[model samples]
Structures are given as structure tokens and as C-alpha cells.
Target: MGALSDVRVVDLTQVLAGPYCTMLLADMGADVVKVERPGGDLIRSSPPHLDDPEAEPYGGYFQSVNRGKRSIELDLGADDDRETFLELVETADVVVENYRVGTMESFDLAYETLAERNPELIYASIRGFGDPRTGETDRQGQPSFDIIAQALGGVMEITGAEDGPPMKVGPGIGDLFTATLNCIGILGALHHRERTGEGQYVDTAMYDSMLSMTERAIYLQSYQGSPPTRCGNAHPTLFPYNAFAVADGYVVVSAFGTNHWRALCDGIDRPDLADAYPRPADRLEHREEIHAELTEWMATHTTDDVVDRLEGSVPVAPVQDTDAIFGDPHVHEREMLYEVDQPGAGETVDIAGSAIKMSKTNPKPRGRAPLLDEHREELLAELAAQHEAISEK
Candidate 1:
């Protein structure tokens, strides 16, 4: 049994955020039933490129997020299917969905509707803004994608360089972060349910979660002087505490403490240079000179040389690109990734492993993501039997 072996999640979510949350639960040994519509989730059709657009149901994006989930196709709008879904809520420990604000209500499947059947259900909703405050209709109208969440929530403003055009990260970082926040809230509510024999709603707007991540910028405006600016690769508090040039790539050095500054001086065999700048202002004033000197010195050294001379002794690291990150020693030891032999992708593709560790329960991947509606019959039978039983009494 894994950490969440007892939890059962009915995933009425599609695309990213809600699905990602259910994926986390499924990864930890929860029973996650992915209820898709008749046409299946739109992600199945999304592409970087597919071997066969019509034939291949497991696209890369869909496959990655939906792992360890059992899929069932149903038309939630159908009267029989709606009753079937209500049956699922009656038995579910949690129901996670990312439908627009009133989408569930429109289908007559809102938390209030589900809660009447199963008051013990942990109902989670992922919206664009929030349900109560942020305009409900605003979220319901047009689809608010991941970039929309980041772009509107001040993430884009502080992402790239101060002068450069605002940029979104390569991955759907906003959705993933918001999904994680949703998981945290759901877990809390679940624990409360276990204790008090009660359940509650967990709602988080992706925009709200994104805004929370920019706390320093937002909070600084109310109290201190200025809103935080994008410094590219620079740290907030110290000089020489950012990425620096090196022989093959780069190294990040944090000369934060006086002792660390002295250690750098001692390590580089430049004691006199250390005394030249003792305080923060001293380093800040001569930052260019210091950076230039450090860069020139680093240009002579390899990444190994950087680590060998001052890895633990000082806060410095050789900048690792993608390959270096995968081959890093710690990644191997911790099993942070796994080489999974995928169905179509022939060779083993490295996938991220579980971050959460449990001493007694080992959470291993049970199965790859299902083909569209792969377990439809199995789950439909489950719903039919459940609805039948509920109607009996």
C-alpha cells in the first residue's frame, strides 16, 4: 500500500491542471477513475506530431499526465450518465475537475449537487480566477489557457529581462504549479474528512496560485518601497550571488556571508582581494570590477575545477544544461528519473519519478496511461451497479 492507498478519486478533469492533481494522487496509489466524454479529451487530438492522427490515441502530452489512471467514456449531459456520475460522487473520496466556473452547474453536477448525494466527498474545482470573487462569467466564456494564467497574473512581467519582451516558460509551468497547489489543498481537506467524518470543497484559480507565487513582488508594494524587478540571473540580496562565466559553461557563486567571501578569497589564493571588499556596499559599488575579475579567473577553469576547489566550501556550481542535469550523480542516486520503455517510442524515454518518499510504502508506477476510454466497459458496469444500488434504497 502506498501513501494514498485508501483514497479514491473520480477525475472529471481534462487537459492539464485537474488531471495533474489526480495524477499525483494516482501516483501515490489512489484509485483514480478518469471520466472522459464520448469524443474523449481534447488532449488526445493535440499535437507536436502524431504517428497517425486518427489511429494513435496516446499522444505525448496526453500520455505524460494521465499515467496510472483508468479511463471511462461517458456523455455527462445524458440523463443516465449524470445519474451514473452522481453514483460515483457517492462513493468518491474526492472529485477533481477543471471545468469553467458554471460548467458543472450547467450540467447539474456542481459541488452542491454532488454533496447532497455524498456529503463526505472532497469536491475540488480549478477555475481561471476564483468562484466567489473573480467574475464567474469571465471564466465561463472563453477558454483560459496556461499562458493566459501566467500572462495575466504578472508572471510574464517578471519572467524575462527588464527590457526584453515578456516571455512564457517553455513548459506549462503555470498549470503545473496551480495543480500542485490544488493537490495540497485537497490533501488537507481529505485529512479533515478522515478525522471529523466530513468533507469540503477545494477551489483554487490558476491565476490566484500564480499570483501567490509572486508574493515578494506583491507584498513588497504594500510595505516596502518598490515592486521587485526582473534581474534575469541575479539574486535579490547579494553581489556576486548570481550566475557567472566559466570555461565550458557557467557557475553560480553566492558570496553571501563575510566568511564565504573570505573563503572564496582563500580558495582562489587572493586574500588581499578579499579585504578589498568586505561589506555589501563595497561589493555592490565595485560589482562590475569584481564580476569582470571573477569571469576572467573562471574562464581559466573547468566545471570540475569549480566543484573541486569550492563545491561545499563555497556556494558555487557549474551551470548544467539538460544533459548534465540527467547525468548528475544525485539524480541517479535518488532515482529522480526512470527510463521507461514506451509502447510506440521504441527506446526508453526518461520520465520524472515520484518526489514524495514513504518509508513503509513504495509507490511504483502500476501502468502506463490508458488508450482513450480503455476501461470504459469496466467502469460503466461499476457506475451502473452503484446507481442501481442507490436507487434500491
Candidate 2:
């Protein structure tokens, strides 16, 4: 049994953010029942399928975030299916969804309605601008995706090269960050319910999450009275904290303090430069010159050579691509890369494993993502049993 083995979640979410949040809960042993529309999640048809082209549904995108959960088809628009969903919610500890504003109320499945059925149900929503119940926003009705969140939330403005245009981050931090925050909110509500026998509404906005992630820019703008721009790989305050090109690849190095700067200089056999810029402020002032010197030094050496000389002395790591990450011993040791069998693909594939480690109940992916409505009969039987038990009482 896992930490959340006793908890049951009715997941009325699709795509990245909502699925990811419930996936985390599912990893912790929550009985997550994913309710899909009749047509199913659009991501099921997303590209980059595994080896089998003929596989029924073979998208890594959908499989990665929807793992360890049971799925059932439920057309909420239909009266019978809506009633069935309400019954499921009545027995659930949590109900999570990522629909746009006012979508749930149209079907009469809003948190208020669900809460009436099960007073202790923790209802959570992940949206682009958050629910108005928490706080009103001008953009409450506007639909937003990851890039929109990144751009409006100030991360893109301070992410690229100093001379280049604003850039979107490679990964979808906008969605994933909100998902993580939603998970935290749900956990907090669960704790409160445990103590007081009361449930609450939990919500997180993608834009709000991105703003929180880029808090450095907010503080910088407030303190300096000016917006910060992109500085490429270099930091705004710390010198020698940037990526340097090596013989074959790139490596990031950080010499934040005087001691680390001295150690780095010594490692590179540039004690003269270190002597010239002894203080952190001095180094910051001559950042360009120092970067040039370090760049030249690194250009002549391989990534392995630089790491060998400064691995323990100064913080340094070679920039890794997916192939390098796949073969990394540290990743394997930490169980960060998990291999699971994909029944739809008729083969095994590697998915990212959970990073949140618990001492007593270490969470991991329970199984592969289910095929569409794979657990329909099983869940119906379980629900029937639950109803019978409640009736007997």
C-alpha cells in the first residue's frame, strides 16, 4: 500500500496539466478513475507513436502523463452518464478537472454541485486564469495554452539571449508548474479535511503559476525600477555563472563566491586572472572579460577534461541531450527513467519516473496508461459493490 492508498479521485481532466496532477496522486496509490468523453482524449491521437504504426492508440504524449490510472468513458452531456458521474463523485474523496470557465456549470457538475453530493469532496481545478470563485480576473474567460502563459507571465521576456528576441522555454513549464501547484493545493485540502471533516475548492492558474516561477523578474523589476531582459546563460547577479562551450559540447559552470572563484581559477590554471578579480563585485564588473578568458580556456579542452579538473572544486556539468540523459548512470541509480510495457503499442517504452521521494512510501508509476475505457467494466462492478455496501448500511 502507498501513502494515498485510501484516497479515491475522480479525474475529469484531459491533456497535460490535469492528467499530470492526477498522475502524481495515482503514483502515490490513489485510486484515480479517469472519466473520458465518448470520443476520448485528443492526445490519444498525438504523434510520436512507438514502434507499431498499427497500434490502436500509441502516443507517448498521452501515455507519459496518464499512467497508473483507470479509465472509463462517460458522456457528461447525457443524463444517464451525468447521473453516473455524480454517483461516482458521491463516493470519491477528490474530484479534479481542467475545463474552461463555465463549462462545468453547463453540465451541472460544478464544484458547488459536486460538494452538495459529497460534502467532504476536495474539488480541484487547473485552468489558464483560475476560477472566479477564488478571485476574479479580467481574462477569466480567455483560453490560454503554454506559450501564452509563458509570454504573459514574464518568463519569456527574460529567457533568451540579450540581443535576441524573447523566447519560449523548451519544456511546457506553464502547464507542468500549474499541475504541481494544483497537487500541493489538493494535498493541503486533504489535510484540512482530515482534521476538520470539511472539504474545500482548490485551484491553480497556468499564468499565475508561470508568474510565480518567474518571481526573480518580479522582484528585480520592483527593486530596480526596470524590467530585466534576457542575459542568455549568464545570471543577473552572479558572475562566472553561465554555460561555456567546450571541444565537443557545452558545460555550465558556477563560481559564485570568492572561494569558488579562486578554486575555479586554480583549476583552469588562471591564478593571475583570479588575483586581478579577487572580490565578487570585481568579477561581476569584469564579467565579459572573465567569460572570454574562460571561454577560450574551455574551447581548447573537452567536456570530460574540464569536468575531470573541476568536478568537485567548482559546480560544473556537461549539457546533456536526451541520448546522454538516457545513458546516464545517475539517472538509472535514482530511478528517474522508468521502463514500462505499453499494451497499446505492443512494446516497452521509457517514461519519466516520479522525482518526489518519500521515505516510507516511495511513489512510482503503478502501470502503463490504460487503453481507452479499459477499466469500464471493472469500475462499474466496483461502483455497484459500493452502492450495495452503502445500501446494506
Candidate 3:
């Protein structure tokens, strides 16, 4: 048994955000039945598919995020399939979707409708702006991609190089972050339901999540009466908190205050520069000069050298990329990465593992993403049985 062993999720989400959230649920031992359209998710044909259409529809993009979930293909737009979905929803413990705000209502699968039949169902939604509740729906519209969310929600304006135009982070920060927040809300709602014997709605909008992610800047703008600026690798307020160049690699160092700065200077055998950072206002004024001095000190040192010298003196780490992430020794010790064998895709690539590590019921991805709706026949058979029984009743 895993953490969510008893959970059954009807996943009607596609692309990334909602799917990623369902993937987490699937990994934690929830029975996630992913319902895709007949032609399949837009991702199946997105890129990196089997040479023949008959073989597999699992695009590498889909494979990466959809792992551990079962798939069932249904043309939801068609008349016959609506009953199948409604049946699934009636029995489902949770129903999740990220369709456009009205799409589910258009399909008659909205929480208001489903909860009439499934009072205990935890109806969760992920959207671009927000549900009709938190505002921003009518004025701004229901559709927003990750970049759009980041742009409107306050990330794009403050991200990227100081000299460069505002840029999206390399990762799909808005999408993934929204998924994470949605997952949290789902868990919270589940907990509330479990305790009160009542199910409630959970909603997460990319806009709201992105705004929360940028709340500091929001605070700065509203209360401090100043807007945020692009700080490159450095933090908005923390001192000496940027990545620095090293001999063979780069390391990040953060000395938050005078005491840590003093310790860092002494550790480097250069007490002369201790608190040379001066007060916060002064250091903020002389940031370039201070950065230059620290860069000069670390210019000849390797990443490991700086780590060794500054181990306890300050917060420091090497600037590690993806490949480096897999190779890191700590990654091995913590078992933070997982590997699986693909039949012919060669060796299984190291992928990030479940952050939820339970002692009693630890769960993992059961299999690679299904080759399109490989389990369609099996899933439809079950739904078919339910359908016949409902008709007989």
C-alpha cells in the first residue's frame, strides 16, 4: 500500500500542468485513469514517436510526464462517450481536469454537476487564470500558457540577465509550479474531506500560483513602493548570494550578513575584506565592487576548493547543471534520482524521483507511459460493464 493507495483519480488533463499533478498522484499509488481524446493527447503526435503509427503513441514528451498512469482513449466530444465518462465520475474518488474554464461545464462534467452524483468526490481544477471565484476570469480570459502566466503574473518582468530582455526560465516554471500548488490544494481538500466526511472543490490557477511565487516582488511593489529589478543570478536582498566562477567550474556563495561575511573572509585568509561589505545600504551601493573582489579571490579556486574552504563558513554550492545533478554524490546517497529500462530506447535515463518518501508505503512509477492509449481496450471493457449494469438497473 502506498500513501494514496485508496485514491482513484479520473484525469481529464493534458499537456503538462494537470498531467504532472496526476503523475504525482499515480506515483503515490493512486489509480489514475487518464482519459484522452480518440486521436489521443496533442502530445502523442507532438514529437519523438515510434516510426510506425501502429506501434506506440507515447511521445518522449508525454513519456516523461505521464509515467505511472493508465490511459483510456475516448472521443469525449462524441455522444456515446459522455455516458462512459459520467459513469467513471460517479465511481471516482477524485475528478481532475484543466480544460478551459467552461469546457467541463460544456461537457456537463463540472463539479457542481458531478458532486450531485458524487458528494464525496474531490473535484479539483487547474486553470490559466483562476476559477470564477478569485476573479481575473472574465476580463483576462481562460487561456494562458506558461510563458503567458509568467508574463502577466510578475515573473517575466524580473527574470533573466540584467542586460537581456525579460526571459522565461529554462524550465516550465509556471506550469510545474501551478501543478505543485494544485497538488497541495488537492491534498488539503482530501484531508478536510477525510476528517469531515465531506468533499470540497480544489482550484489552482497558473496566474495565482505565479503571483504567489512572486509575492515578494508584489510586497516590494505595493508596500515598499518600489518595483523589482532583474538581479541575474543574485538574490533580491541576500548579500553575496550569487554564483561565482571557479577554476574548473562555478560555485554559489551566500553570506547573508556581517557575521557570515566575516567568517567567509577569515576562511579565505582575507580578513581585510571582512565586513568590507559595509552596511546593507553601503553594500547595495557597492555591489559591483564587492562582487569583483570576491570573484578575484575565487578566480583560481576550483568548485571543490571553494566548497572545502567555505564548508561551514557560509552557504555555498557548485553551479550544477542537469548532467551534474545526476552525477552528484549526494544524489546517490539520498536516492533522489531513479532509473528504469526502456525496451529499445537504450539505457533508462536518470529521472527525478518521487519527492514523497514514505516509510510505510513508498510508491514508484509502475511502468513507462503507455503507448498512446494502450490500455484503452482494458479500460473501456470496465466502463462497458458499468454501462450495461446501469442500463439494466
Clash count for candidate 3 is 0
lDDT per model, in order? 0.79, 0.92, 0.81
Per-residue lDDT tens digits for candidate 3, residues 1-393, read 778888989999899899889988888888899888877777765667545544444556787778877888877777778877777888788888888777887777678889998899998888887777446446334578999889988899889888889988778888999998888888888899889989888889998899999988998898878889788888877677888888898888888687777778887888876645556666667778888988898998888888998887688888888888888888877767776544355546455677777788886776677665768788778878977998999
Please provide, for model 2 over 1-393, each residue's C-alpha lDDT reduced to its tens digit, 9 standing for 90 to 100.
889999999999998999999999999999999999997887988977766755666478988999999999999999989988998998899999999999999998888999999999999999999999999988997988899999999989999999999999999999999999999999999999999999999989999999999999999999999999999999999988999999999999999789889999999999999899999999999988888999999999999999999999899999999999999999999999988787755668899999989999999999888888899899889889998998999
Model 2 segments more than 4 A misplaced:
none
* Alpha-carbon shift of residue 299 in model 2 (angstroms): 0.7
Cα lDDT tens digits, model 1, 1-393, are 878889889998989888888888888899999999888888976654345434454566776778888887878889987877776777789999888777888998878888889889998888777675234534444567789988878778777765787777667867988999999999999889889989888888888888898776787677777766666666555787877777788888888678888888787777886899998788888877987888788889887887788877899888777798898989878777765444555544556667777778866555677777778688878877876888999
Q: Give me the displacement of residue 328 in model 3, in angstroms.
A: 1.5
The count of residue-pair clashes in candidate 1 stands at: 0
TM-score against native, each model:
0.89, 0.98, 0.90
